[model samples]
Target chain A: MNIEEMTSMERVLATLCHEEPDRVPFFLLLTTQGADVFNVSIKEYFSKPEMVAEAQIKMQQKYGHDCYYPFYYASLELEAWGSESVFYPDAPPNAGRPVIKEFEDILSLETPDVFESPGLQKVLKTTEIMKKHSGEDIPIISVVMSPFSLASMQMGFENYLDLIYDDLDRFKELMRINESFCVQWANAQIEAGATAICYFDPVSSSTIIPPELYRKTGFRVAKRTISNINGPTATHMASGRCLPIVDDIAETGTAVICTSVLEDLSEIKTACKGKLSVLGNLNGIEMRHWSPQQTEDKVKEAISKAAEGGGYILSDNHGEIPYTVPQEVLTDISRSVKKWGQYQG
Target chain B: MEFEDTLLSLNRVAAKNIISSEFTGDNAFEVINEIISPTLERIGELWAHGEIALSQEYMASRICEELVETILPADAPSRKNMPVIGITTLRDEHMLGKRILSSFLKANGFNLFDYGDMGPESIVQKVKDDGIEVLMVSTLMLNLAHEVKKLRSSFDNEKIDTKIIVGGAPFLFDRNLWKEVGADSMAVDATESVEKIHEVLGDAR
Candidate 1:
């Protein structure tokens, strides 16, 4: 086969090594749309592990992105630890009530066993299913939110942050507990057939907290889980605030740092060098309202700035492609990338 | 015992020091308006300018909430027949922004019922049942525009007269989105929300 049609796994591996792949790799932190591809109700799709796996496979086959991120976040590690939550067909899950209603509750909470938890089991099962269906050449990115983001779900997002300020000791303790779970779960996903672990770490982003404090708490603990993982780790921070901390996060040994649409690509390109792959940085919000020509223009611009040295992949900013993105607009992105992201060598 | 000291203590995340002031409930509202208000705005500005982390700003909000709850009167003499208003995040979750909106509306003396996180049916049913004069919907995700539109269609079908107000990141990013989704008005922040609520309830000064 021609270099233009390299497998996604080859494409990703090439980009990681800072080599010129046939074309720029594409990353989609895709979920939610799985239901649409399978023509199943969102409720039916999210509830069954097989249906979920099927949805992800269909999406992978259809989108043909370099890295297939198949994640359905329902507060996995936190739910295992007794955090109350409810998931809807339309959106992500949230805490039904704060698990640690009082600061003292953190002291008594113990991390659940990876083998014995429903949430962990579901994640493992999904990975196994995806691995079975995805050929050897396809790279499956197992999605794991960082300890800090999961901690936000355990208590309320705001309450979790307030506790960080209100009681640093307790917050550290919580991080210790949550990080332990993340390590177990991430390794479990790896064992169950994941090629790479894509961790969502938005809570530590500059959008939510300062780099100094994030480095102290969420970033520090989140890094603990990633550092312990075996191989090919990708970390995603979805807020524009992630810009200021790119160097620090890159220092954490993540192979890829999927930034949101707000990053300055020139700064990221300069900062990342050969250390990490810069995926995403697509303006997912604004693109949802843009014309097809505008979408193509954005794809071309992102490629020109970030794809030059080879450690780059084009992608939608954070989360799924925007709700308003038509299939045609997505096609525009893929077409634009193929046209502009060619390797000269 | 001044409000600003307590809030400043909270700003520093000194949780206990905020309570040491020991003001009564009636006194709590006064300090919240005069002292906590500007401090919260400053905190917003800091977050906006990237001086503080997003999580730290959230911590400030949660701090302001805990401090204010101590002073929220169990029974502030209702504006006798003040128009009752309800607030919720349509469909999914985003509690802080809506919580801030509810707190501001309550401070302004509009009868408020916070529905927390709920789907369209529950929100519309409550507005219809409680005779909520204004239904305030706050959502962060762009997809939630459908939920807002659904609520509007429900209101129209039921012939409910309650005013609808929408806010959050999406509406703020695209000003026309609020109108397109069928909301009656939109606010940029808690303070502007209070003014919008006043206008919606026909109590604008």
Candidate 2:
């Protein structure tokens, strides 16, 4: 199968399940650049449905990337919980300051309804538009927060850690609620015709939390949620140290694992052992920060090492950072993927 | 109490806020001044016993900086009579402490200018442009302390009468190196920073 001949469904499922694809399918955390390149600001994109749809279309047509991500994860969802968030026309929301002043506040916290909150509702709405526009054309993977990451946003990471041991019951209650919202969000996307769901679990990475705590908290809810979902679910471990807990994460029943720059691809492929497809370990920050040639070299190196055992989706080690990863680097990365990522039977 | 408990207490103190009854942004530092310094000393004790993770200590330091943002006032009456102070980290770009010290001085009525992540020449330029009377440089990494010596030389050459205050994880770990950086004052935590700055600058009043 080649790019034009294969349907979006075939391309996604083939690559995610560790099988040969017509060609390598490319994806990105295209929220920031998609907005920039397409001329739709984040607030406008989120608040208005038509703007988001137009922007998604423009990013694909203009930039020629394979997939579209409705980027509402990091600060937006947390803002719905009472933290002050500053929004710029071009950039996604940034955490203004922590809202929960004391540990007691965590006990009283309530998870905002996904359908009700403006920020989250924007994501759902964007997914609806993308699903409609893509219309079985290309894969649309909607991103959402994992339980641990949501908790970190509610309170700062330190207070969140204390809650795990200091108040396990309340912690469990919060996770259950957040997980419920996540399932609802993912299911809504599936209904909207989304092919896959990407769960970005940055704060919960093993680098931040010990693997035991990660298993107890982040992995538990994640596994349950991924299992409940119908479409293929990809979990992003936003730190390199998560390699140790690969087995634990794989047990969550996710179809794919996208990791940060820290994990060496050689080690992760051996460890994953065909249990789950591995998507990344691209150096987004380095590539964004380094020269185009350097970017090409790193992408080629990453693709060479990771693309061997079938299930590999090439993207940055992380998502695109704002004002970083110059246009040339993005082009170089795309070129390298085409040059080196050919399937050898 | 356990060592972890003591560290948490310090974090709480450093991170405390006296959210004013009135809407105006000005806040009194009297409450934090009473508790934060002592709390930090106990945290230093906890770290000595290896009770807190290195990350936790770094976080505590960061939280102290965050707490300072709330404590400080945004609007200033004047910099004409007030002592002008500068704060930054060199080589290592950890803005947490620099932000904290900047906010702290702002709260206590200093004309504080932030020359963010600068080498010696840039720091000298900022000092000159801001008419800086006091300079504070921080190094989060141990190896970056050498930048402070370069900063001192630049200041002397520029004929600037600015008091250089050096502090960070590396300098705090070694007293001689802390002094060797040629700073007039230094402190390990945000609370101690208050006393250290006062001793070197002789009452910003």
Candidate 3:
């Protein structure tokens, strides 16, 4: 069957099941770029659920990708801990400052009610709006940060490392708090109509931590959190290389894993065969400057490497598409995927 | 106290004792160059190869930073004088790389203006205002890495002769990114930044 014969929902479901779909599924991960499509400032777009839903629908219609990621930004998760996000006119919002200034602050930190946090509520509302609009046709991909990764943002990365070395018990205590909040927030999104959760956990990546450390700390947090997610989960390291710890990632029981541009797609596909589906490896950093031809070439290359046997979703290695990418580049990706992403019996 | 082992094990007390006992005033630079710099470099290599975790490398760098400050303060009389240098993370909040690079340079007796985290426009103005001859920019994200081009354009528009050197994950991922962004050179790690600085400055040092 041609890709046109299948709904985006069916296509993604098929790929997740490790069955050949009409064609390879792809997600553009238009997180911040959705604001540009909606013609609103990022701060405004994130605040208004209707606009975010409308923008995501418009982006899906424009690019014809298979997934709807109703995400605002990573920093929104940190907001539940009283961390503020700094909005930029031309860039995605960044976490302002470390909320946990001193190590002792972790002792008083509490797991926030996801429903009460304004930023998180906005995300949940956006997910609900998208599900209401395109629930039956598109797969809504919601995101939740791993407690290990969130610990870095709660305190500065350096401070987090210091905490780990200074007081392992406090670090673990902080992780417990973050894990509770993550589970609550993730289940809330599932209740809000998300089909699957993308667990964004860059701190666990080999780019940040070695496999042994991940096995000792991040792996345990992921395993416990994922088991309680109440929905399918895809592990993503946000462009951080995962090959070194791919086995540990698979052991987390996530249904899918997003590979980084730093690793070979074929190697990851081979490593993940029969274990977890793979989605991505495209270099989002360089995609902005790529010509349509270059974009198509990359799409074909990724498809040729990982799309066989139907366990892959073509996407940029980084979970979020930068706003700097030109519309033509995205258009070319959509066109190229449809043209070259078809599977043979 | 095994300084290298203590650094790797993230043992701050042992590292401090070793530094205090071995780092006399005259041997400050020698101690850093021979022991601390190489140890950190080895840790960086271990991280690059996935032998040790980033937490190890980070804590090691932090420990070294604290100890090095006591031995060789930024305003020490032994600071270099010729070419004015500056480093900053343009529009990026990830300061580990920048911090590591700054401490490494300071350990090597180079006096550089640490601009912390600033955007392209402010960074450009500061570069011009300080008459910085060599600027090192570190960025963790790709979008912020492109800001180097903006800084370079501003420098050219203002005719500032400051040579730009960039290092970070983005530059490491894309080998030719430094050249594309109009950088004078690129360093793979903090250790290389010192060599690149000397290379970019030539006899200006």
The number of the candidate with the highest lDDT is 3
lDDT of 3 at A214: 81
DockQ, all candidates in order: 0.40, 0.05, 0.51
Candidate 3, residues A106-142: lDDT per residue as tens digits?
8998889998998888888888998988858999999
Q: What TM-score, to 2 decimals, does candidate 1 have?
A: 0.83
Better by DockQ, candidate 3 or 1 = 3
User: Which residues of candidate 3, in runs, are more than 4 Å off?
Assistant: A1-4, B1-6, B11-25, B45-53, B67-76, B81-84, B119-132, B141-143, B146-150, B153-160, B174-182, B203-205
Q: Please state the error at residue A189 of candidate 3 in Å.
A: 0.6
Summarize candidate 2's per-residue lDDT along A1-345 as a digit string, tens digits: 345477645666787777777666667556656556546665555566556666777766654557877765377776667666655554455555566667666567666766677766667777788887777778887776776676766665556665765688878877887787777767767776677888777655665555666777788888888887778788886543567678988898887787766567877777876887777776553443567677768777877777775677777655544433577776776777767766664
* Distance from true location, Cα of A94 in model 2, Å: 0.7
**lDDT for position A59 in model 2:** 65
TM-score of 2: 0.66
Q: Give candidate 1 misplaced runs (Cα > 4 Å).
A: A1-5, A47-51, A77-79, A82-98, A132-136, A285-290, A322-325, B1-39, B49-51, B59-85, B103-111, B124-133, B141-145, B157-160, B169-176, B191-204
How many residue pairs collide in each prediction? 9, 2, 0
